[model samples]
Target: MSRLEVVCPAGTPAALEAAVAAGADSVYFGFRDGTNARNFPGLNFSREEAEEAIAHCHRHGVRAMVAVNSYPQAGRAELWQRAVADAHALGADAVILADLGLARWARSRFPHLRLHLSVQASAANPEAIAYWTERAGIRRVVLPRLFSMEDIRTLVPALPVESEVFVFGGLCVMAEGRCMLSSYVTGRSPNLDGVCSPAEWVRYGREGPMLTVRLGDVLIDRIPPGDKAGYPTLCKGCYRVRGRAMRPFEEPASLDLLSRLPELMAVGVRAIKIEGRQRGRAYVERVVRAVRGAAEQAARGRPLDAPDLRTLMEGGRATEGALARGWR
Candidate 1:
């Protein structure tokens, strides 16, 4: 049996160390620029900070992956190219990428560097995975959050490269990196620029006894006084379609599959991912520890504990996500 790698998030240097100390096999993060999906202010790493963090992880026998997973602007490829070079120079175990051009550039420029495809590419099948691995040399592909265990098993036998799947944290309802909901409202792109529903455009207000959450002037949800208010991320927002208003895309909840660790490993999954790079160190540490404990237990052929992930979930709600084989 292959040892399942516990891939955790690290939005900052402190979070990187926190994840590593929490028993993560690998930690992934991005730079302060628009090169990553979590482009929120006060998050992400500087070049010096990234170098130091990579060295720290290596010293502790943990791997570090730099996320340069955004599309480059027209005629302005230097920024993305430099990020790839910088990651390689700092001894990153790999670079997580999204754009086709960026992947090609990274493979050509850094022939020996490991390249992992970001979930943003939406490669859920073997054909798509092979296209990148053969053409751009992507060694591993992070499967989108839209596949079931059956879907994963079917794709695994045909895949030419290794696969990583999200096991915990924020659930992306839309196809990874393909949704334009944030840009339609905030004029900020999630794929090309690495930001979705940026904090600048989010607002919370009250109407009589109801709390309303707005994203760039568009009212996403209104809750009663006692109901919890979630961050307006477009996808999780309640909306009206044909006179009825409800959360059609998905409810505001996090993904917690810690109890299903044995099944995930049994399906030939190489890595288990936790998704929350914009969160704090405490969140990073707690989630990492929980998933690590469960994954390690499963690796030893022991039953995994039903982890109490309520404290780490959004609005105290969590689901198995598409991994349970639900939805179409």
Candidate 2:
């Protein structure tokens, strides 16, 4: 079996170094602006930092991918274009992009720079993937979080380019780049501003023994004093459905797929991406190390000794996500 590439996250410079030291095949990160997703406070690299980070990765024989993945705002396309140009100038191994116009511009202006289709592009089928590969020379496509293993088995061989899937980390229930729930609650858009339920608008309060979390003025969840509280992303919030308060959309849980590494490899997946650029260096190091070992074992046709990552998961809970059988 071909060895699967472990594409890890690097929200900060420290995280990038940690990932490389922990044996990541490649590291993906974004700039400290609205041009890419995960545009959060105290996260992502500045241009100079990106240059240094790419150089550091190359020195360690690791590939660096810059995420210019957010859609450009109307009349502010230059910011996204500049980010793509900057990634090329910094010698990024690839630029993960979602915008059609920006992809075209990058292909035309910097033909040598490899282009990747970010999950934000929501191209899960062969037809869409083929279009991007044929038109813009996309080298790889990060599949959406919803595809099952069987779906991947069928889709991988038919694709024109390499396929990457999110094997671990936080899971998005809604189709990528299409969710506007956070935008409705907060003015920020994950697609345009590269932030969803941005930190500035998130607030916490206490009501006697219960802890309340709000995204702007809307209450998302209320955790009992001893219960673990989760970040207040609108979709993961508890809401009233059919007169009963429940989590109708999705419960707060991280995605864990280490147990399925062999299946992923058997199906011809080229890379496994970990999501969490907003996380810290410790998280990056531990995750990369565990996944590296798992991928090596899978490549060797051995049983994967998957690490128990419950504590590292969101709310100390994890799911196999859409990989679960009977998932529609």
Candidate 3:
């Protein structure tokens, strides 16, 4: 099996330093504006910060990727255009993108710059991936959460570009770049505004013994005092159906694929991505360091005796998610 690249997330400068020090093969981040999907308060980089980030990563012999992944509003293409240009100018190893217009623009503007198809594009299969690769000159693709280990084993050999899969952190239930659930209540789209539950619109209050979280006026989740409040986003929210309360999308558990590292290498994945740009340096350090060692173990064809890292995840629980299909 080939050595799998350990791609990690870096939301801030401190986290970027931590990830690079922890042995990340690559560190991905976004601009402070709505150009990237993880556009929460105090996350992402300014142009000056991006310059320093790329330089620091390059010093450690690690690649740096900039995410300009969110869809641009119809008339406002310049902001996204500038982000793509700056990523290339700052010597990013790749610029991750979703919008067709933005992809087209990036390729035409910088012919030699490497382009990565974002998970937001949801280009899972060969046919969909072919369209982006042909039209926008995509060199690598971040696969969505829809594929299982079996599906990935079957799919990677047929794709035209390098395959990158999410190996750890948060999970998304909806098809990327298509969800409107957040906008229905907060009037801010993650696809456009780049925040799922905008922090300004998020409210936390007590409903007797239960703690209630709402995005604007729409209630997202109710937490019994000691429980973890998870993400305060709609994807993991529990609601009543026919008087029975349940989480219709997915249960409150973070994605943990550490044990499957050897399986991923056997399937020929070029890179493994970690999905937590909204997290802090401690989380980045712990997950990246653990995953780096696990990848090395897997590369040697040795069975992985890895930590589950459940304490660092949302809800302090872990699941393989769709990797095992109907998992309990």
Best by lDDT: 2
- Candidate 2 regions with alpha-carbon error over 4 angstroms: none
TM-score for model 2? 0.98
Per-prediction TM-score, please? 0.97, 0.98, 0.97
Give the deviation of candidate 1 from the true structure as CA RMSD.
1.1
lDDT of 2 by residue, 1-328 (tens): 6899999999999999999999999999999999998999899999999999999999999999999999999999999999999999999999999988899999999999999999999997899898999999999999998898888989998888999999888888889998888888887888979998898888999998888888988988888877776677887888788999898878889999999999988988999999999889999999999999999999999998877888998888988888988656
TM-score of 3: 0.97
Query: Tens digits of per-residue lDDT for model 1 on 79-115?
Result: 8899899999999999999899988888888899999
Candidate 3 structure lDDT = 0.90
* Candidate 3 lDDT by residue in tens digits, 68-137: 9999998898999999999999999999999899999889989999999999998968899999999999
Worst lDDT window (10 residues) for model 2? 223-232
- Candidate 1 residue 207 Cα shift, in angstroms, is 0.9
**C-alpha local distance difference test of each model:** 0.87, 0.91, 0.90
What are the C-alpha RMSDs, in order, of all predicted structures? 1.1, 1.0, 1.3
Clash counts for all predictions: 0, 0, 0
User: Lowest lDDT 10-mer window, candidate 1?
Assistant: 319-328
